[model samples]
Target: MLRTSECNSEQNVNADGYRLITNENKPPDIKYSKENSWVAGVQMFVSFLLAGFGMVAASLLLDLVQHWDVFKQVSEVYILVPALLGLKGNLEMTLASRLSTNAHLGHLETSLGTLIIGNLCLIQCQAILVGFLAAMAAVAMGWIPYGEFDIHHALLLCASSVLTASFASLVLGLIMIGVIVISRKLYINPDNIATPIAASLGDLTTLALLSWIASLLYSSIGTSVILPSIIIIVGASLVPVCGYIAWKNKFTKQALDEGWVPVVSAMVISSAGGLILDYTVSKYKGVAVFQLVINGIGGNMVAVHASRLSTSLHTGQKENSVLGKTTKLLLLMVIPGQLIFLYTIGYLRAGHTSLTPVFILVYMSAALLQVFLLLSISHYMVLWMWKLGMDPDNSAIPYLTALGDLLGTAFLGAAFIVLDVIGDKDSDLGD
Candidate 1:
């Protein structure tokens, strides 16, 4: 079910169904270089700042619109939010990670033209299919459990999810290319820089676009169904056209054939988080606001960890000596960085929580556990995938980021539940 083909490269799939690209990778593995701890600290901290702004912006936007009819009426928009955002991690960040690995391997110097075109085309094709599937998945997840299905609601969710995914992928894909290209020119590792920027903007762009598009389409509902229906049809139609272009390119056909287990499986995992969000949002007053920031921060930090491990593996450094230092640096930033965001949320105009001692303890506990586990997994995953003949660049990121979302969402939800329980017990004591 997995295959990767490159010129002069021998490829075979393992019994576990992962593809191994062998012996003849055209670019030589560069020896691992010592990264200055100071340079890495600054790079990741700056990236985290940008991500904080983005997460805050997304939180504000979601807060501003949660009472709006589009959210109230569709309900599945909550489902779409995480699913669509996860698509960015799955599709765009993966593209950035692959391109980063290629840049390190010197492919950009040797085969820039074909690699760029084929990669850009490949993601577009993926975005179309996965976007629509995410939409359908959102609709099904939102409705089937409750046995409540509305045609109009289904149509709106699909249209908005497609529009958000298509347009966001296009825009983010270009931005990621620019980020990676600039990183190469500056002699900065794209792994330390690109993925966090992608994650930051990914949440910001998808949330803004989804809200705007859903709002625009929602206004026409009951009055007219023309817009949503056309989007559903056109978005559905693009899958094949994009697929054909991607399939015809010798560079991309292998990935096209590789199909969607990683991305789709990631989507399904995020939907479980979405269901958690839906179930708890009303009961836990500010959980939705914290969800985007918690999930984005956890995912963003771990993505940096995963991308670094992938790059190190590609450079043929199997020892933890170098990687251990990198992990410590990344984790050091993660603890304090998340603390800033949590307090920043308290300062936000709406969806503000008291930031009580217990909540901080509980919330930080969850975030810490999520990142630690993900960081631990990243090193092993890249090594395991590489040994299995699978390209970790293409495979590891989506799963890591998606799992980050699930853990962030689940733990954040639990934090709020715990906070409420203690408050109730205190009320009884007061009486």
Candidate 2:
């Protein structure tokens, strides 16, 4: 039997050989070009811009729907829009990242049968749960009155969002895999290309899905609109049946044994922890619980990745175990710092209302800057490690994601603090 190390090494060799053979025969792809670096940067910048626009657009739409006589009866139902959009983007990003990782490992199959269906079911369940929580939070915050909102409307909106988002995720996953494959053919590192592209596409897809769902819900179209929704649900449900038939005919049950335990374990732990943290924060803090839950989960994921990296290194499989641990430790330290920063910003923003525009502009500017910095730094770090012979899938991608999340949160929090300080000084001078 092959040892784990031997198996890993063999995989790495195969991956490297594949890359070399493809590059030798193909022209460089778009992402491989130095010119495309600027293109990717521009795309990412536009994504950030669109994220802000999406939020504003959602807010305005909510206001409009709230005032409409036709929607007045269900106006409170509109509050779920922002939350659903947020979850749509987030879940799409998560699924995209996982698919990208699988593609990099050459584990991704083109057959859209079982894998696609499984993902759709999982994402739909997740999206529905998130939508419900968002609706509940909106009620708790008095953003929408509890008695004004129909639970059925909320459920319908949640179902729509999940179906649309899941379909968008599947399409985006397909596109991302193609892009990565082409990038590999051109001698470009797919890791550097996948996340940014997938994230941008995820944002765009989320916006489009939100708009489409809203149209379906509010348009003159009747219940016949439900046909599309039903089709998606039925299609997803059929995946397991088809997969079982395929397995029974061509493969043994033993084939499913590999990596099942670890994948299931990670899913269970992450999902449970996410639920508990979300519940705890929501009960105590209300809608603002999103930031804290995101921070905590992101931080813990970094800790877990650090632990895994350390184990891998000690077993003589890698050289940069300490690097992973060190990066994670630094990010862990920054968590408290981030919380303090967020609190300080909230206090200042509340106290200095006159400087609100300045505060908002500065805060947004800082967030953009932080995103750019985080992307650049983390990208290069992973590339450097890869050059030093680390496996991109096992060692680089997880750490990079964790680091990006940690730094992104920290920088966003810090930006708010800086803006607050500036606002405070301006207020003091006016006094």
Candidate 3:
């Protein structure tokens, strides 16, 4: 009886030991249950699908909006559509990225009324300036007759559109941040999801706002005193509101403390350059001054290099070779794209309407080229940084985008002049 009891006890001990080993080996599977895994897969799939659709839809909507009746009546509206939509996308992306970072750092607040209002005012200022310049450019190029659309009318319509779009973007940015936060809680990647979604939404919202503003302008004012009066009232109200915000936020002090001098100087220089270019193009007859302006502004690629040098100085990082390579790659890609865009604009203005097919081909080619170049440069830069024992994300890609815009515009202008002069010589000989 004693021997039989001992054998049973030994067998029970062996069984218990096997159970422990099995649990330990199956930990990974246990940690990821079938339900949890399925949910994660579904979420990721949905996010990616939405992102793809959003990009495609936004592109189509922008094309449709450009051809809408109001814009068709004023052909310069074509240029305005791209400029405004690009600005909207860029701003929304910036704001969304900032908010996402803040959310990650636990610094974002739900109360965005003040922020939204402030952004709206800034956007209005930008839109008015851009609209005036665009209209003036069209007039100078003879794309639109000068007296047909006054600067004031353009400014008012633009301001209304900009204000509406900017407010909508702020709300969208907030929503994107919230989505990002939720995704993070679910252990999903937010960076891959937030920016693209925000940009797509911004594009659609901008088109809608522009359409609504056009409707309002046509129905309510139709080129009259009421329109001007509304613009004045809104502009006046914005001044005080901006002033109040500046005071409440202590923006002056903040700016000074945070190295605002360089930034402000850059902005002032850029704006002044733009205005001078506008004036020169409008007043002069010898050359395409708009192209000159774009080149002058775009060629100031010094900002990115300066930022890089500053980073290197502060961090004692030695990556000059990598930086040079990346910058060269970007310039190669961006310069050609700008040139093609400028060429299309010049040809279109010169009454080469059939060149539209060529323009489309060039645009698509440049876009694809830019994508590949950007990806290559970004990958190499990141890889080089990783090799050097540093976080690539901490580098200045964000600043690069703005710097690229400036340079791209300048390059486009230069290309336009070259192409236009060649075309003119051919025409003169034929005549």
Candidate 4:
């Protein structure tokens, strides 16, 4: 077992008894050195810029939606979209955050042990479990009124979600770990660069994989049923086995114990967001493009905060306070992002909708509210997890971004109501 349960700031001494240490415990001096504020701001600016493009790239899902034949055939795919995206973002974001924290603690280099293997196993297991549940949800919900309760579709949804999630978890998870490790070696704050890159890349890769799998299923229903059946059996079988390993290991146990709250909550909330998108996506030409971007940017901003707060709590620098210098700087970073994306991308692509002040106000208000709520929740979640001897990095980003998806969707729907943006309820869902 790794000696990671130690919490005392004073006891963080080196092996030589000379107080020498690594970068994990010693965060960069940005919080203390006022001179570093400009550098911090510049780094965050670039990070969010990448995040904006990354999220916008994910809008290619809208392209899939435009294919009327495929879309009408696979209506449940709409429901699967947010859940799949949320699953990818949640799993990868958590991985990036945890790796950053581990790098900070110098425990990252100890890679050949049970903890590492357990984490990899846990990621795959959770992806499969969550994917299965999400597909079941889509099937169950579709049956209620839509009444498209074909077992074939359910199997496709289940198999596709599980396969995409597992594959992405393994591929993107390794890519992110490598990125975090390299960035840290180069003196870049993995906290700053890691989360956005992981999240954006996660969005891109997950959607691409999902599209491929769904297209394959559409190509041949027989092949789809056979392949997914095998995948579901294998994936379902491994869940318990992986759960047992995570339960036994010291490092992964804390994660396993606490992972469900964020994952389930995010899924439930993202379902709500999905419903809103389903209702309005047809009427609002560019809403599909902007929804993920807004949520992505909002989530990315919160991830940076969550990663920083985790480091502070672990290193005993900032306690649980959310209004520190770093928080303020991060909060400031969201303003221009909201304006730039909402005006340039969201507005322009919104089918020549007038850039009225009311539109801007409603959108900005919703985006900022989402950011603020995520930050507050992240701060408290980190504090609460820390109090219980758990690592917040394991769950914080996942929780925040999932909630961001929920709230961002809610806020957007509310804006639609206030401004009457969604026209003719029946027409909104036009075939």
Task: Please tell me which predicted candidate would have the highest TM-score against the true structure.
Answer: 1
lDDT of 2 by residue, 1-431 (tens): 01224223232333322211121122333333243434434433343333333333333333233344423443333343334434422444444444443343333333225435544444444444344454445344333333464444544444454455456655765665566557655644443344445543544455456555645664533444464456446645644554454244211122222223322332233233333323332232221212322332232233223222322222223333334433343333334433443344344342222334565455445544543444345445444544565333323333334343334344444544565456433332111
Going through the candidates in order, what is the number of backbone clashes in each? 2, 0, 4, 1
Error of 3 at 127 (Å): 7.7
Give the winner by lDDT: 2 or 4: 4
Q: Candidate 4: what lDDT? A: 0.70
Worst 10 residues of 1 by lDDT: 422-431
lDDT of 4 at 61: 56
> After aligning candidate 1 to the native by TM-score, how far in Å is the CA of 152 from where it should be?
0.9
lDDT per residue for candidate 1 within 1-431, as digits (tens), equals 11334454455555644444443434443322567778888988898889777888888778777778998878788887787888767888888887887777666776677776777777877777777787788888877888988888888888888888889998998899889888887788788888889988988898999999999998887777788989878977877887787787666666666547788888888887888887877666577677888888878877887777776655545445434877788778767887888777667535746667777788888888888888888778777877766677777888888898888888888887787777721211101
Instruction: List residue ranges in candidate 3 displaced over 4 A.
Output: 1-49, 108-156, 219-223, 239-365, 375-431
Candidate 3 similarity to native, TM-score: 0.49
Candidate 3 per-residue C-alpha lDDT over 393-430 given as tens digits, one digit per residue, 9 for 90 to 100: 23323333333333333333343344455453222210
Report the C-alpha displacement of residue 8, candidate 3, in angstroms: 66
Estimate the TM-score for candidate 4.
0.84
What is the lDDT ranking, best to worst? 1, 4, 2, 3
Cα distance off (Å), candidate 3, residue 308: 17
TM-score per model over all chains: 0.90, 0.45, 0.49, 0.84
Indicate the residue-level lDDT of 138 in model 2. 39
Model 4 Cα shift for residue 148 (angstroms):
5.0
Candidate 3 or 1, higher TM-score: 1
- lDDT (Cα, 0-100) at 71 in candidate 4: 58
